[model samples]
Target: MAISEPASDQRRAFVLDLPQRLVCLLDGASASHGRASLLLVVVALVAFLPGFFQISPIDRDEARFAQATKQMVESGNFVEIRFHTQARNKKPVGIHWLQAASVTAGEAVIGPSALTSIWLYRLPSLLAAVGAVLLTYWTALVFLSRRGALLAGLLMASCVLLGVEARLAKTDAVLLLTIIACFGALARAYVRPRAERTGDFRLAFIFWTAMAAGILVKGPMTPLFVGLAIVALAVVERSGSVLRPLRPLVGLVWCLLLVLPWFVAIWFATKGAFYQHAVGVDMLGKVTEGQEGHWGPPGTYFLAVWGTFWPSVVLAAMAAPFAWRARRDEKVRFLLCWLVPTWLLFEIAATKLPHYVLPLYPALAILGVMAIERGALARAGSRLAGLVWLWPVLAILVSLGLGGAYLWFGSGFGLAAWPLLALAIALLWMAARAFPRVGPEGAVLTAIAGALVLYTAVYQAMLPQMRALWISERLAAVVKEQGCPAANVSSFPYQEPSLVFLVGTDINYVLPNEAAALMKKGGCSLAFMDERFTGNFEKHAAAHGLKYHAVATISGFVYNGGRLTAITVYRSDDAPAGSGAAR
Candidate 1:
């Protein structure tokens, strides 16, 4: 009852032909830089925009970054960094300045109400992610065929980590764009012969300027990634000749010129506390041990890349043989030098975040496509043939995992996601079946079809519907619906940065007794008392003679504590005891 071999072969050919045509179409498009660049921008937007406007402010990092930016917008303070009364001394002011500019532009063009829209804060990240894709293509062009470069950009546009970074208002996405810009210029200069490398001033400007921008965004990281690559290449080739093209001495002074003003300003502003915290504590502490519980052993990124890099990660694995054989090639060695040393350093570092190695992903995508170009990819009977299943199998597993999350946390199966889910899986299955005829390169293009669809489903459909996971959003909505949008709230036990961001800056993070005291003073006062503090709140309320009761209860998972939390919001309309003043 099985299908005939000829019939199956025909089916495989039809499936393979589509990806083949896609590859050809991109190659033709690459003939026109405008056409290719526009295509990459479109791809990046499609990959990044599905949940950009819909998802709530993520806690810990994204919300903290956004709130600090908001404070900058309000206070008109461009240099000093703060989160409420506490100084956010960890990072430089570049991102906050960019985010402030974004919010200001939104308010000016879109309306004053744009100040509160979370998407406005994330606009920089989305644009930066798109810029990184284009830069990836530009960087790959120095070594790869135009088609291969386009493919690399497409892979970056479709990556899981980039998409995540694009949606959040943080430094990583912007940092990524700068890093790739550095790579684009450095890769160009590195692959040339030492004798011909007379240091083009333009390339040096781009490299050092990009490095400066990276420093302003995140201290030390840009130099660390770029410097490590420079050092590694010098050590590997046993010569400092390659460094000539970058014009090291003059470029260093130019880089310092761009960054020193801010460093000097911040030093004077914080009395040197900024460097002590940003360098001595935040940076080094992360190297020695995990800060904020983001700890992982070595090789964590190797496993995380399967999901983080998605479709192209499988192809990158398939390209290992080619990478080994071509390790000595000028371009290949440059890429490996760019990728390996920093990667190993991060692996050795005690602090490990998934995005820590994101700047290196462009190298992986280029290598994968290079393998495909050289016909070194997996064939039907090849040793890497088993990896043909990795893409499709991972696609299915990740889809099921996300769909399960939607069902488990959202109180029901996400019915709206059914069509998209089926489409994604069906395309992946087709890609898997075509592997024998099309090979890894074509198969990656086909698998990306599924990945793009899955991204849409996960972000636009499933993630937005998981309301319980976004507790701060619910709290904000309830307060607004109760006609107290500007109510002063005292939140206890569940003081996530997202709550501080969504509810307002004035909200006090306090214990039950203090929350009760705050509510006793005036009208339009609110308290989000955790269930654990219910008794204490009631005791304090009785003592203060404050007539307040829980209007609504919110239940959700708190990411920081990794536990389910239940908080009851208490509202009050009482005036002060003696004044009888109505609010």
Candidate 2:
């Protein structure tokens, strides 16, 4: 058992009191919004910025989002979302618009050549990630002390899912921001008594407007979660008090004002195809069954939360007993209502990805802090105390996973990552070892330290060094180095958006023979033939008298499909093309 905080506070301890002191520092910082905000920004940036610029554009969604936004920047089409003329109608225009703005600003500041930078496209996610972290702090303030709120903010900021989302050019990070804000407002209004909710009008605006932003970003997810939580709250409390303060009519009108313009414009532009795909295909498909291969049985999020939530998850486990025992507490009830129904919905849904439950993570963060403040965390003598070992064990497992992946796909031992991996494992071991002495909340800081080291190694060092996995980045590099800046490129038997985003919009997704034909057309034409179709490319090259030479042969795992994809770039030797090419 741990000593009471009141008892610990009496002593002027240094190392033993480090955890309490750290909590005090965060609490002190939260006294001033400016100082807290700055500190959180620094924390968020450190957590998010490791592989932000260094990593290549991830395939499928991230690349598709970036390409669509690049097209938006190129064509100045704000309403119609597209990926190289194909109507990307599955999503609304909010994230695309944000990404477009980020790219445009980047180009202006760093010259037009900066348009292709993946980091520029990812700016929205990064900034939105920061906003989400700050919002987590603010949201916790509604129900928690300043130190607890700050701790919640730190927990969310260092999270694995949020960190991954922050580095990608996708809607999740921004959606997370809007959802946190929207729920934060709703939580603020609901957790308090009706008489005490003086700023009902302001809360209503924040809730509805943030939900509106979520609507524009992912369409209906934000409102869906809020609606469900409110319904659950109403059922549990048997009161209209939660809904009465929001003034639904006015808030809905405000939300419509913010969200309708784009929907209406996209409706006019896509001839209502946007809604057909966005609703009928994208959103509904997930609800009905697995759209992509992301199918899992129930409790997927439960299993995944261990890794995705990471260090916080250790404390979350310790908080479970508290949650059940204190279920009737208004603060506990509010968080339970906010988390449980939404969590059950996602768990029961056929389509499951780790990030689908990201919005629920904030509730966990606040709840964990609440557990700590109340001395409700599972003690060393408790039956659930063995859960502490999960921290260090997961660290070792994660290290092994990384090292095993590198050994399987890398050139050498990946020496750059091993030291950090060792450090991460050590820190996590320390967290677990210190759990009995320092308690769950203090242990969280140590685990987060471990996570930071681990993520830095994974994102900054390990993943980047896995050159065999970034097929598109390497392909783009081959094309750029071949002395044909404006080469008409063809990727045979396979076309990925990352290639289009990094290479050019002029790429042709052609058959092996057609790729060879593109090469025969000469004038700086290059064909990127997948290894599976390399034989066909060569046969067509011979049959068509396409005089071409192999510029480079690259093999890597295509992240979209998670398979080995080998590509050979062949250039027609008939004529040099592009202004930069040798005549």
Prediction 1 TM-score vs. true:
0.95
Model 1 global lDDT (CA atoms, 0 to 1): 0.85
Off by over 4 Å in 1: 1-10, 378-381, 485-487, 575-583
TM-score of every model? 0.95, 0.93
Model 2: CA > 4 A from native = 1-24, 27-31, 196-199, 378-381, 485-487, 577-583
Which candidate achieves the best TM-score against the true structure?
Answer: 1
Cα lDDT of model 1 by residue, 348-441, tens digit: 9999899999999999999988888887874315677677677678877887787777877874677878789888888888777777776665
Q: Give the Å error, residue 76, model 2.
A: 1.1
lDDT of 2 by residue, 1-583 (tens): 9766664454424333655555566767778777787878888898898888888888788999999988888888788888975889888889988888888888888997677899988999999999999999999998888778888998999898999999999999999999899888888778777677554788888888898999999988888878888888889889767765677888889899998888888889989898898889888899889877889999889999998998788778778888998999998998998899999999888899999999999999999999888877644256766787787798789889878888887767888899998988877776776667766766677778778888888988888777787778777777777665444788876688888988887778878877777777768778878788888889989999888877777877776676887777888887663322211
